[model samples]
Target: MAKLKSAVVFLIFLTSVLFQAQEREFWLIDTETQQKKIVKDSVSAVKFLDSLSKNHFIFTELKNVKKVGLRTEIYYDKGQNFNEAFVQLSDSLSSELKIEKQFYTKNLDSLKKEINKKYIDQGFAFSRIQSKYLGKQNGKQKVELTVVKDQKRLIDGFVIKGYEKVPSRFVKNIEKEFRGKKYDEKNLLAINRSLQNHTFVSLERPPQTLFTRDSTNIYLFLQKKKVNSFDGIVGFGNDKSEKFTFNGTLNLNFKNIFNGFESISLFWQRNPDRGQTFDLQTDIPYLFKSNVGVNMNLNIYRQDSTYANVKILPAVYYHLNNRQKIGLRGTFETSTVMDSLYIQGKDYSKKGIGIWYDYTEPTEIELFLYKTRIRAEADLLSTHYSKEEITAGQTRYFLLAERNFYLGGRHYLNIKGESALLNSENELSTNELLRFGGWNSMRGFNEESLFADFYYYGKAEYRYLVSNQAFFDTFLQYGELSSKALGLRPKLYSFGLGFNFFLPIGLMSFQISNGSEFGNEIRFSDTKIHWGILTRF
Candidate 1:
């Protein structure tokens, strides 16, 4: 008897182990017909229920979960009244979704999520979505969805750190752009980009957003940068006698010296042909805590033994945004012929009012100057010729565009184009015509060597970055000009190679270039060489 009992107990233990090893099956049942369908596992069971729910058969309960196989019961009915639930949405949003009085969606949960996203974009940061079942009514499931827009959050202000000396006006301008606007990712990114390439400051990192009870605040960590600079360039060229001559340019810029984001610049240049230029400009980006600003410029130009021209320009501008501005400028100019026998030059005075637009986009890389820059101006002036005792109307237009495109790795392409046109019914004198050449314009030629009433030029430079502070570049330029005084309409081309590298004091630049008329052969004698340095303080 004892042996038989022990054997019985061992068999029972084995049976229990086998039963536990067997996988349990899940089933979905139709309550009315008592029909069932097999489900693979718990995950599949949940998916099956979801699929049925989408088809208006919602699982009411899980039955016999711990028995031989799991079972769930579902009832079939028409889904929720989406039209009633959508009544809570704004008219614009409801129209955007195209929800009608008989609106329906197979995936109700997805619809709810999409609706929630729309609210979030509208500054409803803490919005909630809730759904409830009101049981079957008229052979259809009665359901309700509620959108709980807890608090509408707007941008309250900014909290600045890392750089405390930032111009108050600059901060205020940013506030004017974003304060009281929706607190969303799009606005946050715009705020970040506004500070990315600022002339006076740079972001230490991306901007941060903080949320409070009913308002949002942006946190900015900025670093003050040195944008003021002293730049100089010296050129070696041949004079009319084919003798080597030295010419150079100087630029001194002071920016934000008093922490008001103002700028003052002085520039002087002398060409090999005895021509000289002097320019002084001052700019106040903001005055009296307002977005309106003022700029004043004074320029003097002397053409060797020919004529001298002096110009003064005053402008008032409104900031459209961080990267753009539009302004009205008044131009006053006077010119005097040095030699009475010089028939080609003229003594004249000009008064004009014009509209101008400027745009600048800073490069992502600190080593590069700008990603894109554009300046355009249109003016109508009244010109008085002292020698001829005549007055006439003149229209002038100017445009300059520059862009840098990255081609992966360390390669980049810089393209620039500039054009100017002077239109008048009266004759244009050599002194009044535009002059362009040399390192800053049509490299390889003498400074201000080419004169024209209309001109346009394009330049393309390919660069290979050697380091953050060094680069090697080769450039080609092509242009055409019309000069009535010279009776010439000529096309010109120039090519050059240059390199810039950083030194202990500043950046050093060197270039060798040659240019000639399009149909003329290039000669070694036409080559121009330049060396320059730029220091920031």
Candidate 2:
């Protein structure tokens, strides 16, 4: 009797366990679409169906989860509140809004957020989602969600703090453009970037929102900082031809003149190689209220004993977007080369239409530990020199890439490379050929000491930040200049240690390095000590 009883107990226990397992099966249904998804277990069914209420369109619902036999059936429907609210906002009215359905649960969540954002971006300031379970439907369970799109706000006016003398018309125009439109984050960011580019003001902080009874307003707070309107340098240097030299430059910049987005600049430089140079440039952005602008430059260059040139460039440039630009220029030149033993004096007039493209992206400036910046340009021109007896074309290409990474709190890695190709007709003159080997180029050689048709430069540095604005660095540079007719030696290499200071005025660096030309024997007598200031911001 005891053994029989024990066996009966074991059989009952097995049956109970199997029954509980069978109760876990379920089905997930989309009533409007008439589609069903089968779920194998109760735990998974509950989790998935519960997620649907929070994961569908802005106001979607998973209505029910009721067990019938071994299967749980889930019921889904649209929320009436959201459906009816949007109906008033649209031209067509329906009692129930057709839910924008989503397939994959993974993407359904993202789509729901995007839908809510559309209302928020359009000034529905109090829009939100609310979900709840509403018992059973047809022996299954029910859930409902309601979207509350509370109020629609319109832009009233703008308040700009700082710079009190700004014209009211200018403020009114800016406000008129956005007064009745939707307030969007992206548009605000674009405006900030544009203002920074033209006005030299940083708008990294977002505009503050102020609410009134009828609508909303935006307040832009401006912080004024040092503006780079004037820059000049004074220095002495030696080049390949001259053992000693005098150099100085003076620049004047007048920006946003008359509040019409205009820039005028005048530059004058005196140096031994070029004697005296003067340039005047003017830039007008958004010319005639369009996406294109005109730029004019006039340059007068004179070398007392050697040569002189007067060049004029007038270009119309189009901005494809923020990161890319293109321009077409008509150039005119008149020149005279002094008569020397190897060449006769000549006067020439060359005219050409040149096209150029520039691309720049500096996306990693704010990232931690690493950063990257890229710049590239290409220009082509074809001209006829009447006195030189050459009908020729010139092509110029330049590319630069820089990478910065922090190895630790202090150690940093910097790698930079630059390559240029200058091509012209075979009968090009002495002043037209390309040259390298300077503090800015090969680093340890005399200025303009290497002539080439093409050149490549690479630099690598390991640096330690001594302060917020200063760094100590060790660097190596390699260069290769190739020429066919000039027979100039090609390979140059250098290594050095330097300290760099990044001041508000510019970047200043000092370095001492030894350069070597590799040939039958390596000769390394060029010990160069270089220091300079550069302010191209």
Q: Tell me each candidate's TM-score.
A: 0.74, 0.60
- Tell me the whole-model lDDT of each prediction, alpha carbons only: 0.82, 0.62
lDDT of 1 by residue, 1-537 (tens): 234334433433443455556655555565555677776554565555456545544333333222343222222222343332222344554576566523435466677888888888988888887867666555444555567888888999998999878767788889998999988778888888878888998889998888877668889998888989999999998866787899999999999888778999999999888999999999998878778999999999998778899999999999898889999999999999988899888889999999999999988876677899999999999999986899999999999999999999999999999999999879899889988899888897998888999999999999999989899999999999999878999999999999989998898999999999988999888789999999999
The top-ranked prediction according to TM-score is 1
Write down the TM-score for model 1: 0.74
List where candidate 1 sits over 4 angstroms from the true fold.
1-152
Clashing pairs in 2: 63-141, 63-142, 63-143, 64-141, 64-142, 65-141
How many steric clashes does model 2 contain?
Answer: 6
Best-matching candidate per lDDT: 1
lDDT of 2 by residue, 1-537 (tens): 234234433433443366774545567777787788786654555455455444433344545445566665667653432211111122221123444321112342354466577677877776785545455444333434456877787677788876534444445556756777666676566555444433434444667888877777887776543334565555445544746665556777876645545678898876535467789999875676565778999988766677777889898988665445688878787777764653633456666676766554432222112255565656675656666567777777777777787688878888888887878765455445455665556766555556677888898888888876777888899888876556664677878787877777776767776676666343343456666564544
